[model samples]
Target chain A: MSGKSRRDFLKSTALIGAGVTGLTTTAKAGPQNILSEDRMGVLVDTTVCVGCRNCEWACKDAHNLPAGNLEDYEDRKVLDTKRRPGTDALTVVNEYSHGKNSSLPIDVKVQCMHCDHPACVSACIVGAFTKHENGTVTWDTDMCIGCRYCMAACPFQVPAFEYDKALNPMIMKCDFCFDRTKEGKLPACVEICPVEALTYGKRSDLIKIARDRIKRNPDKYVDHILGETEVGGTSWMYLASKDFAELEFPKLGKNPAPGVSESIQHGIFAYFVPPISLYALLGGIMWITKRRKELDEEVK
Target chain B: MKKFLALILVLVFTIGINAQQSPGKDHSKLNLSCKTCHSCDVPTKSDPCLVICPREKITTVYQKPEQTPELITINQLSDRYGPVYFSHKIHAQMSIMSGGCENCHHHNTSGPILKCNSCHETSRKREDVSIPDLKGAYHRQCMDCHREWSHETGCNSCHTLKKDLKDTKNESLQKKYSGKDHPVIIEPTKLVYETKSDKGKLVTFYHDDHTKKFGLNCTSCHKQESCTKCHDVNNTDKSKNQKVVTKKTFEDQHSNCISCHSKTENCSKCHGEKTLEPFDHGKKTGWALNKHHINLSCAKCHGSKLPYNKLDNKCLSCHKGWNAENFKHSITGLQLDEMHSELSCEDCHTDGNFGIKPSCDGCHDDYSFPKQKPGKLVK
Candidate 1:
């Protein structure tokens, strides 16, 4: 190869390496990963929810989705079939029959749990997902490559992919109304709930409130608080009359979801030792083969 | 000067002690246990260490339905909806058959009835979340019974949306409920029950006999009744043509009757082959009730005790105050003349047996009861 072309190629490679290192340094310094002590959270009291589905409509409207009239949500017949959050709708409320009283069904709103140690943030290949200090785990659409690694990693299976769209499909999930809350306004679902079953406040204060409710109404609610320690805790917690497993919540351990995979991946890539050693071994093999062939040619 | 200073200090100490001892309110007459309000053993005036809103332990202030406000406009938390026009008087009256004032005003103390907001904060994002916010409290109190009977959880049942207030219907509703009282409940005279008993299929209940003859209060048997017992909106149309028989446990079916009826009594007393007639005094006890006795409650003749005591057939048994002086002969439809006015009642009523006809054989042989004129036949 000519020396000039080789020099140009070497310059380009150095510039790319510098750019990658700069991006990694900035990501490490960003405040998005910090878990603030005063981060806000929401407490859902399932005992008080009336299965109105108003939260479902409010969530769609806030997210600029195709939400129909508010009166349409009053139709409880939709609750006959269970549903999960989709790309079109960011949240949904499902109904479960109360164990004691059949007339009063328990309604649970399903959405992104916004976990403290989010698997989506860890699994995103492009560094698109961010766990903000405000307890909101949001995804940036610009950096997404339609990998759908987040969908597989999520313990709650919250994030949905827009499979219908041929171009620029985005990952959708509840953003905890970060835009509205930034303006000192309440989340749409919490605002629209007629029963005030969803209470929003500091995460620390919310835990105290949830404990107080369970203490006050011992007979009305089960003692366990869902999402308190499940998957290393979540921004949204729940108080239910029956066990959360009965409400179709996935049973998970207290450890963070990405703990095992991240430990192995980070261990191999630490200080770039494994990749450097692999390249050195391959280079040594090629040199030995070339030297042997040269010696054979000389002997011939 | 030193002595005076010592005296002043003693007086100050005594006053301070007295202030600490009395909380200024008369808790002694409240009839409440100390632990109900106070978390600590010794609560002082400065630091009562009171439990937070001892709702179950507090004494509720009960006012008559008429004394309560007729209309209460709830606009404190109105945002998307207009103010709710609540008919407080009607609800208060309807509460009589259920749980009374304590049902809604569960946390009221022994004073003027406390408003719901006194304990329940108005803001949903308040610091203290031990109790529900005012909006939640109000909705829960209303929806508990309303949903039970009406099966409606729609907000439109109580609230009118701000955009839908263009018509005069809201005003008309406000006018309709203003100063309105719940209509008086009409009681049933008789109710017949078809029982599953093999001995007797028909069980007759004399409703009028219990209220008028036995003088049982409405609350005596209707304790803790749900509003759906009578005001079930879903069953209204169906119940009009057919009787709605609810399935109940055996204990529930006989609880009200067993409160008064003896457990050992024969089942045929209430249940028979056919519907039984109303109780007749003469047929049951052979003492036909007269005009005066018929109007009197059974409690007045027989003491207020259940399983009333029986009295012999003598006027003196009940009327111990009766005598010739106070007992006017004119009350018997016969006013004695001047000659017989001074005589004793025994002259006419032998052995105080006024149930029998008067005979003159005690006085003159020729003077029979009707043959001779006693008092010119006053009647």
Candidate 2:
């Protein structure tokens, strides 16, 4: 951000002492996460989705999240109430009205956006979260301290902390089916979408495709492409009939979310000047208070 | 002042020359206002500021089955299955019987049937979020019938399995649809149903009378019906015999006739003691639909919702708009001669109805229809 924030960031790494090298390396990486140019994306065409929750079932099954028979997902009653992605269900589809007084409803599937500049990785005090080169924002369960800072940082509110687990808990969210994609398979949700509403491809190629569609069918679509530039780009994109805000997507800026937090945190720790001054001030107060007590005891 | 005028003239000449440099596409000839294409008031090469896809003034389009495309290859989207070879002609012809060309080509503004990709995007990765993608479009259209008939959607039905992954189990589908005819829909003359009505158990439906005498189009009553209404078999599904669920509730069954006819007030019209005979125009209205009127649709004379008995028997009541130029006089059994044909029908026939017999008293004092021949008698 500014010279101040940059120094603060450097000072924090300096204060870490022995692990300073590793922390500094991660901070540089965190600010500018080097991802493959060919990192993939999933384009969710909400209009094509029929509210058949097959993708939801497939996601649960793939994640081993205790999903019932996939056929039961056919009952569209679940869509009557809008639901968000939780620990058990990695992905969920929510229904929004297509237009004013319109009978037809648009089904928008919600999950992790897998930001190019991930806020979770930035917010994690420990180096647990990773912005993988393949465009997946994943977290190491063993390293997770259950701080839930990622939950606060994520713009989409994707990551959920397992509050019920008394012994061991972990952050849960869509991993973009990282394991499956590594094996040359599609994400479970993308693979199972009956209408093929979710199209998986290179992010740049997907943007080109989306722009082409908008140009060809001007009457059918709004010009803007969601997730293309929102919060400095995300791997999971969306296409909807109405304004994305009406579809329950939060209004975001072109600037990445982590940039806001990183600037302040970095500024406060810049050059170790504030921390050193703060500690000295506290130490002086402690010394004065003890000296005052000693003088009172000597008088007694 | 003279130098300024000359500079202006030179500027105009340079602009004229620049305008002529671009040829062939004559935008000025279209007589459209510059604002139609140009977004800026003053357009230049660097900042032409052209508008894209201005959707106003949609013209209604019309097409017939024979005039539309015959076949199409849908291969834009890549998946495991091979692209479908769709029999566009066969489907078009079938639609002609059911709902005409608009059954599939629903949103034509003007010109020929629009390509599917015109409205539907070819790829799933698209910005047009209102209409479906090409794959979705094809499936949604096809599944209207496919889902209704079989209630199962296996990809191999429309798409052929890829050559490398081809199995013996996958049926040879590409060859089956060439020039395939959906068998002619048979119309029954009458159907007598036993209804739950306490006043009358039987309800006789004169199907032929409604179509022939009443002149109702098949589509007027069968709106929103699936092809599986009659073509109910699932021959494509390998499953031997799945129970076809072609159930219609009371409302669904009665919705067609009830739109115009009174289902609440006029129960006796349809409900009867036993099977009733076919509708007789002579018995019903005291005037038969004779040779001249028999082939005509009911709307031709009855004016869509106009009652059969309400029309005056006078030919002029319905033929008020017709004149000698439009009403072929030769079709009336006698070809009018050159001299007499010049006179309007009202001049010779004092009465509006031609059955009153024509008189030649105005022209020839002693002449009449049988006595004097004004026109050649073809019959």
TM-score of each: 0.69, 0.51
For residues B1-379, write the lDDT of model 1, one tens digit per residue.
Answer: 9999999999999999989755567874675557666899998778989777745654345668887777888989998888888888898888888888898888665644667887889877677666678988888888777877776677788888998876676588778987778988888888877777777878888889999888999899887878876787665453132232546676778879988886777988887888899999999899898776898898898888877788887888888998878877776667778877777889877888977877777778788776675675555
Candidate 2: clashing pairs of residues = A7-A270, A7-A271, A8-A269, A8-A270
- Per-residue C-alpha lDDT of model 2 across residues A5-36, encoded as one tens digit per residue: 87798787677874877778887876433467
Ten contiguous residues minimizing lDDT sum, candidate 1 chain A: A97-106
Q: Cα miss at A119, model 1 (Å)?
A: 4.7
What lDDT tens digits, residue by residue, belong to model 1 across residues A1-300?
A: 666797799899999999999999997777664478888889999888877788888998999999998877777788899999999889998988875654567889999999999999999999999998889999899999989999999999999999999999989999999999899888999888777888888888888989988888897889988988999999999999999999999999999998867988998898999989999999999999999999999999
Cα displacement (Å) at residue A141, model 1: 2.7
Docking class of predicted structure 1? incorrect
After superposition, the stretches of candidate 1 with alpha carbons farther than 4 Å from their true spots are A1-37, A96-103, A116-127, A147-149, A152-155, A229-232, A241-300, B1-61, B163-174, B189-208, B237-295, B305-317, B323-379
Q: What does DockQ give for each predicted structure? A: 0.21, 0.06
Q: For model 2, how does the per-residue alpha-carbon lDDT over B51-162 read when each residue is reduced to its tens digit?
A: 7643453222354455444566677764766766677767766675566667777765343335778777765544444455676677778755664465444454576657
